[model samples]
Target: MPSHVWNGDDAPPNIHDVYDYIDRELKTLKTKLITKIEKQFFGGIEAIQFLIHIEEIFKSKHRIKRVKSLIPRISGWAELDLFTRTCYEVRRPGGGRDAGFTKDIQTFNAAFQRGIKSLTDLQDELKDLYCVVQTFCRNYQSLEGEFDLKWARETNLELKSAMRGIETLLEEAEEGVNIKLFSSDKFSLEVAETCDTKRYPVLRLFPDLFQKFHFSFHLIGKWRANDQIYLEDIQFKLIKTKRLQRLKHEEYNTLEIEHANLLSIIVEKRVRVKCREIRDRIKNLDQEITKLAGLKRSMMLEKSQTESDIQERKRHLFMNKNVTDIINSKDLDNILGVKKDIEILSKKLKSLNKSLKLNENDLVAKEKEKVALDTDYEDMRKSVSRSNQLAFERTELSKEISIINEKIQELEAIFYRKTDRNKLSQAFEDMKYPAGDDEE
Candidate 1:
């Protein structure tokens, strides 16, 4: 028979071939799914950039509002025309003269609207891809379980069949030897004739006869050749059994290595996905921190202006009249309200400063978390052996993120409280002292 022929009676069926085929299919599917996940993961960058661009647009709009507040309203057509032309020159800077603030604002609003729509669409797509990947992971887990169970069942059956074959061979050898030595009359007569000259009985010669027949048939002159051949076959089978077991062990090791490789691929992809999510969150935190810093600067500026205004009012009162005359009911109430406004602004500034510090601290913590996540991601990506360790690290990072979110919520609450207090203090100040013509 040809060496490649696998259907021979003496040859055990190569059951591992079936497992190899299944494993190949699984590997192909895993590769395709991993590729899809990577593509989607990288594709999310465009969406992230869109969101960042939207934030930039909002920032630009805020700057425009500040500039508009600084520019007093122009009356009459000539003044308005001059202001419009100046705005166009400053904003366009060597571009068209027709470009003006209104046009610029419209353009920015249109871009913002487009960006919002694109971001919405991309977010939806990303969510769908995320769902698909989750489903794939669940299915892969089920497939892994099936593969393990199938492999175990096949290996167990193979081992049991091999043991049964060895037992049958041993039983056959024992039965053949016992019948030839104890139940054959012809063999007994031959043994008696051979031992007659030595005056040895059959029972006395039995040990020597059995040993002679078992080891070397030449001592008995080739008598009962079939029994000698059977004994030699049993010895050959026993000697070859160890070689078969070694081959089985090597095949099992190969299978285990392949399974480990597949599992590592799954784990590495999961880590990369999680790392990307953390990175995006860190970016959002950075943006929020920048926004909070701007708010803090604005609040400080407002507080300084309020303090200066209070000092100016006190100086005016002392310079324009006697201290006793300035202490009338209306003047006293105005002074007290100015002091109250100063006090309220001071408290708000303090609260805002505290909130800003907390945000900075949170930002630092999140940055550190990002670095740790990056390190863990790299380690898991590069080393297959460490994939099992990622789960614990992932859990710890999740907890840290939750804590940071709580801190952010508290900061926001403080900010809102400060805003409400500022509004109440402004109301009291307005009621106690109405705006003068020059201040208006």
Candidate 2:
């Protein structure tokens, strides 16, 4: 094999080339080792005794159980029996098994045959049984220490894993594993039948799961892409775009997530502003309504007092009519005195008529003013109602904004995981898998 040296600054060799070269080297080493052993042991020997000696040599190493067992199969009836049974099983799958299953079985059977042939081929290579045993013993002693260390280290990891599994089982026996059941309503009742009651910290449930936000503000804003959204004001003249798309392939998709979060914040800001404006307007309307009500009450009291004055004047006019009738019914001897009394009473009645007419005119004017105030008050109430509707629409926009934020977070989490996996894979691909030690 040609020696290859790796430079720190140079690019690593092709992975395929590395794999092919390793395969070639292993095959070459195995063939050369087998040839050397055969040449050193080329003589006559009984096959059964030869196989037994090889098995005995393999058995010396406790870790070599699999290879030791295979040695007997080189000349034993069990090997032929296994091959026959495998062939029979391969054909048996043809009756009702799937085509792919049958094909897989056949493939496995072929591999089994190849393995058997490879093992049995070593039988012919063992020419001089006594000489071959000595060579095997020597090779075994040379590699035994290294093999023991490698096997011990490999077994240690498996034993540790097993210990951990056993400890888990013990814990399960004492304190059972908790399995929670959840209802659609997000309400949970703990059922600790087998396990002891375990306290789990309370987690706030997602609002979207139970309550769907009204999307009445669909006209306000909407997501254009997974990471971006478009917003517009009531007049639709001011349009804003939020983007979170990645600039580079290596960059994280978190940019778009941040943009998604911004959408909610923006909506929240609008809601707060609109709410404040609505509140202020409502307060002004309430104050105006109160003033109108107070004015209407005062006007009503003034109207009642005017009506009472008119009644008093009418009563005096009636008293004067009775006095005038008495004067007319009196004798002609006191005509002059009666005339004077009549004149005074007539003047008083005339003054009362004029006052009554003035009061009636004032009442009519006040009634017209009161009607206008009532109309104004009703219009103000309608304006307040419309403002409330707008506030509700803004609230709906907020809920929808929350949902969009959650979706962005979910997408970010998924992308983050995939990005990590891709990074790890790229790192592995970039790694240099050395075939052997550096050559000078």
Candidate 3:
């Protein structure tokens, strides 16, 4: 007989067989998932490891009695006797040949079919998610310490697209499972009447974690390799324990009820046989909680240290505001003004230098001319002495000419002064003599 297609056969598998088959299938499926996850670790393990962490979350959510009772039946992974009894009751009303009962069985079969189909689809989705993750991990590894702009952009796009694909696949897988659950009419009404199904917190928050990883991808170009790794690891664990406080809250309630229940049972029945088991389980839970708390504290400390290191790096690499402002000055007008002043000063300096060069040339030429004239004067005196014996007299006459020129300048000065004095005396005599003497 086919595993999924169960026509109203004379030999339908009993509930035990059905559950056993499902359990085996579930184990196989888990093995496949683990194998796929392990292959994903070829490039890196952070993202895939997150998926494993999600398994822990699933286990925790389903650990509750009510949730545990609902999940298996609803998902068609296991069936409760109540569900089987309800199916039989519907059939018995028509003496096992009711057309409506057959229809109901068909519907039930279809729901299981859908569940099986969803499982297959979920596997495919997981495969695809791992492929993207593998590609993303490879890119991350190859692009480590890569600061090339073009490469970074392309790699970021690829990584981002891969992240989105992973997220989409995860959502589809979740929806597929949920749809499978809702398809079963026997369990649907029952599930709805009971406590609301609590979704896996990590599943809901996974994309956010994916986002955190992607965000770290952006920092690869700017942050040190070690820093990026630390950031991702720290943030990954942080997100893992993000719902811990709430879990602790739930744990408190669960423990109280469980404690009371255990006490009542032990007091009423005097059952010591199961007491050790219960104590061991409680001890294990306490140990788990303690480990989680310790992990959280360590992660927090690492985060703080990382932050401080990053700050120190920034402080060392980046200039202070004042210095940075001066180097990258945005004050256009001030810059322009300074430039203009420098240009004007440069022009003035060039002009002054040119003038000084010209003056130096003129002085050099005049000095050469003076030397030439001195040589000519000496030659002329020598020629004069050679041609005539009166060279000495000529010299004496030249001296007399210089003396006479001086005397001429002095005599002219004396004559001008005497003439002014004579005019004044004459004026005085004319004033004394009057107009009558002038007429006579």
Writing each residue's lDDT as its tens digit, candidate 3 over 14-103 gives 322322333344445455434443233212345434334433433443444554565433322233223333443433333433444444
The C-alpha lDDT values of all candidates are: 0.41, 0.34, 0.40
User: Which window of 10 residues has the lowest lDDT sum in candidate 3?
Assistant: 134-143
Model 1: C-alpha RMSD to truth?
Answer: 56.8
Residue pairs with colliding backbones in model 1 are none
Instruction: Score candidate 1 by TM-score against the native.
Output: 0.24
Per-model TM-score on C-alpha atoms: 0.24, 0.26, 0.19
**Residue-wise lDDT of candidate 2 within 284-391, one digit each (tens)?**
555655665565566556556555655655565555556654555343334544455556555655655565565556545555554655565454455455445545
Off by over 4 Å in 1: 1-266, 303-322, 325-330, 380-440
Model 1 C-alpha lDDT per residue in residues 75-111, reported as the tens digit of each score: 1223233434444444523434234344643443343
Taking all chains together, the TM-score of candidate 2 against the true structure is 0.26
As for candidate 3, its clashing pairs are none
Off by over 4 Å in 3: 1-76, 80-86, 89-102, 121-129, 140-440
The candidate scoring highest on lDDT is 1
Clashes of 3: 0
lDDT of 1: 0.41
- Model 2 scores a C-alpha lDDT of 0.34
